[model samples]
Target: MPEPYEERTGRRQTGPFAGQTKSPTDRDGRAVTFEAGAKQPGYVPPLSDHLSPNQAHLGSTSAASQPSAEDYLQMGIDKHEKSQGDEELSESAHYFRKAAEGGSAAGCVFYGLALRHGWGVQRDEKQAFGWLEMGCATVMQKPSTDIVDLDRRQSLMPMGTQNKLSAEVIMAIYEVGNCFEHAWGVPGTKRNQPNHQMAAMYYRLGAEQGDRDNQEHLANLLSQGKYGLKKDMWEAAFWYRAAIDNGLSPIGLSWVYKVRLLANQIRAGWP
Candidate 1:
């Protein structure tokens, strides 16, 4: 958690990311190199399905034998894109479900998306939450850095042999957090109540991975002292800057830094 070189050189590292700035360290003290993946392929694909939103999560196990979860996910993505009718969208969701059950974190995310949005599947948030959590947990067990460049980066040690983690994989994690953060905002059942702790945990996961949106949300929590996170202006500023580095506009980071400076000058005892 050393100060980012961005605070030193006063410039964003827009060139070769290797050796140009401080690499985050792994839990084992190994320096963590960034390797980010972007938006999931065929995300929010054309929607129309014959299945009722009440469909059950079954039969995916009986799917026509596939090689691996990646293949299932690819099939789902491709099918969704090529879906010619309602029944086809259901076919896409079926493949996504197959991939999810096959243990592809990305597959879990896509399946969850299908469930939540009623895209050729049951619009069931409860089921969606479960699948999404499964996907995020997979990533949690095997985290990756989130810094994109002209090309996809690599984390040879941590990621092991999994398919390259993508924003889609991380989306599963982030969406779970989103469910918790805005729960009560909708004024509905108990499910709507915001679970700050859950939100904070997932947000921090995505943020640490260098996801732009998650960094800002985690920073917002720190600044507001919500989500069981203690108020720490410095940490808030850090994440704000991280968000900007990942693609968020600099205006928000600038404001936070300015606020941190003012707080310090006023001797408000803020971190």
Candidate 2:
């Protein structure tokens, strides 16, 4: 009989790989001896290489998938309204700051409020004034010519132009007036001196823009003749009428009617 195969080959008789065949070629098919733990010559393409040009472009433009300024502002408002604790308020303020940075007027106003009141962030009245001023400028900086043009175009104007004065703009204007009236973030004495003239100016700005709330406040101020403003019953009646025309409810209407009647009487020399 022939010698045992394993003994002739000088190989182990048992154990792993003892009976395995060895190829003349290397592990990767090169005409060389196979070595343990050798580096492989494989390559992995980048993720972008696998995508089409259009897909790559879409991925590059992923910022378009992010929430818009208005979306962030709304989210902030929702969070603030529904918050039950300081942590939630902080989250709300964070979203408001993002929206403000992204150019939402309402976001600027609310961010200012947050800073002023320390609701979520530190109370920094000076910083709050800066944001409030920005919001005020955004609403009040529109050109008078734009208002005239919008009024003239009326039905022909684009929807955006027709609704240029959003609720946020109105609220910003009102808040700016409040800031002036109360000196909340203004530089002045520690006693918080009021800036009646500036308050009246902002209130007029909002009232002129068809904000019923501002119109009512302006009417009250004009009627009272306080806050450094001269008594002007005619102007007060005009604003009261405007407020009524802008959908004041029955309760509001009643108050406006009484004020308008009293203003008329005062103008007509009646006590």
Candidate 3:
């Protein structure tokens, strides 16, 4: 239960409406009283027998057929917060499925998690894998650089297929990778492989497409030979140099260059 506003604030809300009555109290530990049956505007409409058409329009799905992704996510969060019983958990799964079908990437991810854990859904690794795959692929198909301009000096991306990708989308790709690797909601499986390999792949794709963070991560991978990847000294040097030239980090690249030189010297002497 939340603390009543009156209890928290030293001042208390006195009466009902405008010009009806108003007063401020300095009193401590007094329960603030309100006029009985005072009505206010901005009522939160009940979850209608179904969602409104507007919500469906935003989601590209029929409101009657499914709750929007936002609503379902809220429902899941609410239930989780309340530590609800099994019944609520089941309801959460149902809503998550509806939202996922409506193309909510978040919904797909959560539903996949539920399927993996048998929480509010039957434990089904195959289904979970499919949902996880979809979520990852959705972002991969459209890199964030295609959506938004992160540099504040630059203008926003045009509102069409050519639009730049938003930072949100890039972050989502990273999160999806975390999900696959960490088994957050879904179980760790081949679909959700571990250790940054999948992350590296996605980051490389994003970097190649001009996402700054992806570019940086890809550079580090090349420079350090991450994930047991074969270290190509020249290729590594090239990427590090490219990143530095792109205004990423000159110092980091310099360090990598030094290491590359040392590695070459060792190789030349080995014969």
Candidate 4:
């Protein structure tokens, strides 16, 4: 300390405990600062460890045609049937049971579903899982291969089209389609089933959410006075306008060319 401060510049030091200067430099004499919280380039953190904005929105996607669980299981059954068309009941039971045991509630439901339809064997609800319901809930709950396929197909979405939509919206649109088309598993009862009234309700819900398909179905139903709904041309035209807003170019043409032409011909012939 009694000498000048320049005397401490070039002193050679040895051993682990020999360093005494406040400045710590590397061999290149460059001072480096090590930060603990810094992130490296292209680091994708785990889902549980760090959820990004994109990862957080995984469950929110709107689907136009959400296939039911029964639909899925029936597809598998169809494949099996096409492969082994001449197989006996006992032989086919193995295929259905295999699908059932592998967590496809649809598979379980369809074992009963096939029995109900007497596809491969005698109709026996007693022989199947009577309580296992598929489609509406199971399709939404499980991690299905069908859903995974849909995910892969939708991976390359344009940036402007990706929006966070709720599962309820998807289910509602699916219900609307089933009601309009009289799809399988939609209740066939006169009071509660896919009648015009039910179709109208589902269509309104889906249309309010900006689905043009629903708008078109609703318009068609209104135009024809089907499903016990009153005939109202003005109301029908309003729904067509909504469909037009949602990119219904072909739908617009069909309404103009086919339906209107048929209606005009029918009116001309009405004596």
Candidate 5:
């Protein structure tokens, strides 16, 4: 005689898949056979008994039902800001990855941030640098149109679109400079740290493009003579003035005032 279900299967025969048997000759391979009147595991009760009409749409994957890239990005931001656990942070990172893959530079930067800090993903300096670089490259990769062609295209585009594009480009440039300045996602030891010369170069690039933050950063570096740059108070003052003109607030006010005072003294031959 066959053993009882508990003895043979090592489990109580009580659920939907219970009261089933396998062919003795091929017991290991054959599918289970349910006894007559036994409820199959795959059976589901009528939806009318459990789900309301409004809840019927709970599970869907329609094209129109999918979230847009911007929507994903906003969701990521919301989750990241309110995240109190690793799982929530990871979900935020997932949304950021989706947005980045959808070609959003801001998304790329945030994803890089997540990687760098290990907020929602593993800490990977190389990968973070790569994403940040890609974000900057995306902004700089405009079509090779001449100034006239560029102006013509810009004039044809809506004002909001043009402004949005410009903002993306500027933010990308500034962030790239920040990465270089702070050695973010770069590997180095105390004896051979991040190259300040490269940092200054990037800052100069952004500053020339009218980014006030980069202008202020470049001024700070020049004034300090750090990063292999020569000490040139005049040049530093020039950048400080440029930054001020571009709406960089009072951070450099003291430096500007002192530089102007020394300049006045030299001009009046007062040593």
Candidate 6:
């Protein structure tokens, strides 16, 4: 019902990042260094939002070495964080694009966001939604183990990779639901505008994965019977309770209690 983001506010939504690192290389192409816990001039947002601590470890890059998918993603983070102006930000987006092309799910998510907000790039809501969806569209499969190989190695996934896969999926899912709920980047015209049905579907997917914000969103929708759902106050209470336990906003404590009470009373004589 409301105008899309680019249409609503005159400007774009801005926010992205999680980490600190030595500049990697200086003018002479020598390694640069930073003091631990010291905030350098022109500090920027961190990679915390998109990456777990394990995944956010500082990475090094040099002109001579080829960058991997992860490297591209990290380079983008560094650029985005330390960017002095649109030029650097644009460079950051370029790296994110390369990361995505090189098969980084987190890369897809960040690049999608950049497109969505016109961060360092031109705004294109449709493409933003596409990249976001692609980030979560497929389950990251372990490379098939050769039947000839013997051992537990086949089933084991690196913790960092696992964490990256999980966090990125949840991030992409939440963003998708948020887009649907707000009509930010969903496809189509009238058929695509702020559809609560689609939003609820995506929220439930993340809520079931223990995403606090998703749980809250789903709970609100259930409580109000939005999206063609029958008002199920008990279910609403259930999700709100889950959200509370999961933390994040720590929202709806009192409201959840009242809703549970109201649900108990309403259902008491029904069955």
Give the per-residue lDDT digits (tens) of candidate 5, residues 155-245: 2223344233344444445555555555565544232344445555556656676666667777776676654456667777878888788
Best by lDDT: 6
lDDT of 3 by residue, 1-271 (tens): 1123234554432212122233322112133343567332211112111122222222233345546666766675455334334566677678778767766665666566566545556666667756755655553442232212323322222334354444334434544443433333333345333344444555554455465445555555454554434445566565555556566557534666776777788889943
For model 1, how does the per-residue alpha-carbon lDDT over 1-271 read when each residue is reduced to its tens digit?
2233234334321111111233332211223344466233223333222111221232233345645777787778777767655566688889899888888876887787666656577566778777877876644543322224201532211345444445655566566666666552212436535555556667776676667666767776677765444677877888887877666667535676776677677797655
Each model's TM-score?
0.58, 0.59, 0.42, 0.34, 0.57, 0.65
Residue 34 in candidate 5 has what lDDT? Answer: 54
- Across residues 61-168, which tens digit of lDDT does each residue of candidate 2 receive? 114467877677667766665665566678878988998898877778778877765656777777887787677565344322132453454222134544456556
Which residue pairs clash within candidate 3?
A: 113-185, 144-165, 145-165, 146-163, 146-164, 146-165, 147-164, 147-165, 148-164, 148-165
lDDT: the better of candidates 1 and 4: 1
Off by over 4 Å in 4: 1-172, 175-177, 180-194, 250-271
**Model 2: worst 10 consecutive residues (lDDT sum):** 11-20
Model 4: C-alpha RMSD to truth? Answer: 28.7
Candidate 6 residues 1-271, lDDT tens each?
1123334443323433222233322211223345798544344344455443333543344464678888888889888877866678789999999988877778888899778766678877889988887777665333221323313332223334434336567767767776776677666634245555566667776777777767877777677665444577777778888877776354435666776777788889744
Instruction: Measure candidate 3: CA RMSD.
Output: 17.6
Which runs in model 2 stand beyond 4 Å of their true positions? Answer: 1-63, 139-164, 249-271
Residue range 1-271, candidate 4, lDDT tens digits = 0111123323221111112233322211123233587432212112111112222332222342753433443444444334323243334444455555554443554454444334354544334323132322332332122324534543222335445433333333333243233422343233233355545654654455566656766676667675455666656767777776666555334444455566768889953
User: Judged by TM-score, which candidate is best?
Assistant: 6
RMSD of each: 16.5, 30.8, 17.6, 28.7, 23.1, 12.5
Mark the regions of model 5 whose C-alpha exceeds 4 Å error after superposition: 1-65, 139-165, 187-192, 245-252, 257-271
- Backbone collision count in every prediction? 3, 0, 10, 1, 0, 6
Q: Point out the higher-scoring one by TM-score: 1 or 4.
A: 1
| Off by more than 4 A, model 1 | 1-66, 139-169, 184-189, 224-233, 260-271
Order of models, best TM-score first? 6, 2, 1, 5, 3, 4
